[model samples]
Target: MLKRHHKTEALILKASPYGEGHTIVTALTSGGAQLKAMAYGSRKLTSRIGGHLSPLTRVELALYKSRDMDIIKQAQNLESFLELKNSLSRMTKAFFVMELIEGFSNTGVGNRPLFDLSLMSLRGLQSSSNRDIEDLTVSCFQLNLLKVTGFMPELYTCVECRSSLNSNNYNFIIDIGGLCCTKCLSGHPGRAINISSKSVEILRQFDKGGTLFSELPLGSTVELRRLLDSSTGFWLDREIRSRRFMEHMNSRDIREPMSAIDMESV
Candidate 1:
């Protein structure tokens, strides 16, 4: 028998007006399940749970399990991630993370790693101020997200022939979901994107949690971003809406110069 009333910790992914004074919230529960609940009267100014239910907030929620949907009975915020809210650039990236998570997650399917990665990525966006670091944060999150969700790209071998990619001459095919060796690239024409040897190394490092964006050159960062963007889009079947806004912000804002290491030629 399922409990009628229950409580769980959740990261609010999206919140939107439902009716006059109610809100429909989509959240990722700590137990690694996606949840959509109705927050009655939350749109009212005096409602107890109104402010606590905003998107990207981490909150503890008490819910009533109705037949149609869960109802949020009470709430308490756990982490507001205030620093991210202060910077437009970081906040946009944070939204992009949330959007990507939504694309990959399914309701009632428990994926604890996905929930943890989402929290860690948001916290990373909160603390970093550098544009390059922010870019890496999102990029790494995308890579890790793909790994946790079972879409990890094949970096070490040819997806076509299963031959060793020891020579480092490879092309990443988005539709095939992995690398195709140079020898096999001709058979699958048009979709293969040339991947450099260094980029391959960086991706391998990312897979094993061995590298950081700061340790690599800016050019590599840019390269990885393009690769991941295409990869993620192929999986989601639609572009992340927040990405365009984030790129526009990047182009318009002036920030500190890249550090000496990042400026090194790739």
Candidate 2:
């Protein structure tokens, strides 16, 4: 049974201009489905809905069911994540998170845990002030995102033989989605990347729900980033676009700096 009217709490994933002054919004609903709806005249200066439809905003939406797309009749913002928006570095990471969410997520699927995890990750980003902690937040979010989406990498047992992993073996096979033992590495050939024991321990800690960034070595953090980023790209079969901007911003190596408008869009 379909209802004519619908209401839901959603996070605005993206919004684009539509015909005339309207807007096409893509939102991740609280019920865990990706929803697309039209907001008539939302792009106009006088439209009240325009302000609440920006990407990364959490809002309550009132929609009317239509044949092609749902129509947004009303919208009220719930969470603006103002602190996150105020910092450029945090905003870049947040955008990266959103991009990955869209890449791994599918429309019309019941994945409430994914929605909850997404919200939690954003909130975690909002509260953190340290750069190390911020980086850790995004990394932890990615790891949890993988787990929620059923792509969690096996950290303990050998992916090939399902045997207990030995202390000296720390090979993570990106294609196979887990660790490969020394013997299994021979089977996997060049497919395995040799991970340091420190990196492995860090990943294990994340897998076990540890978030404290204190005493975490920078090298290990970078190693984890490379591994997780590669795995995410491999699984999604495409490079995450926002990752480039995030890297650029972090390096602060702007020989060719982005314009103010360009920076704001990111």
Name the top TM-score candidate.
2
lDDT tens readout by residue for model 2, 1-266: 97999899999988989889999998889987888899999989999999999988999999999999999999999999999888777888899999888887778896899899999999998888777888889889888888989999999899889888877758899988899877778877778888888888888898998765666877888888999999888888999999988887888843345678657656
Model 2: runs farther than 4 Å from truth? 253-261
Task: Provide the lowest-lDDT 10-residue window in model 2.
Answer: 253-262
Shift in Å, residue 167, candidate 2 = 2.0
| Candidates' C-alpha lDDT | 0.87, 0.87
So what's the TM-score on candidate 2? 0.94
lDDT for model 1 comes to 0.87
Clashing residue pairs for model 2 = none
Instruction: List model 1 lDDT by residue over 70-186, tens digit each.
Output: 999999999999889877678778988999988888898999999999999899888886878888889999999999999999988888799987555668898888888778888
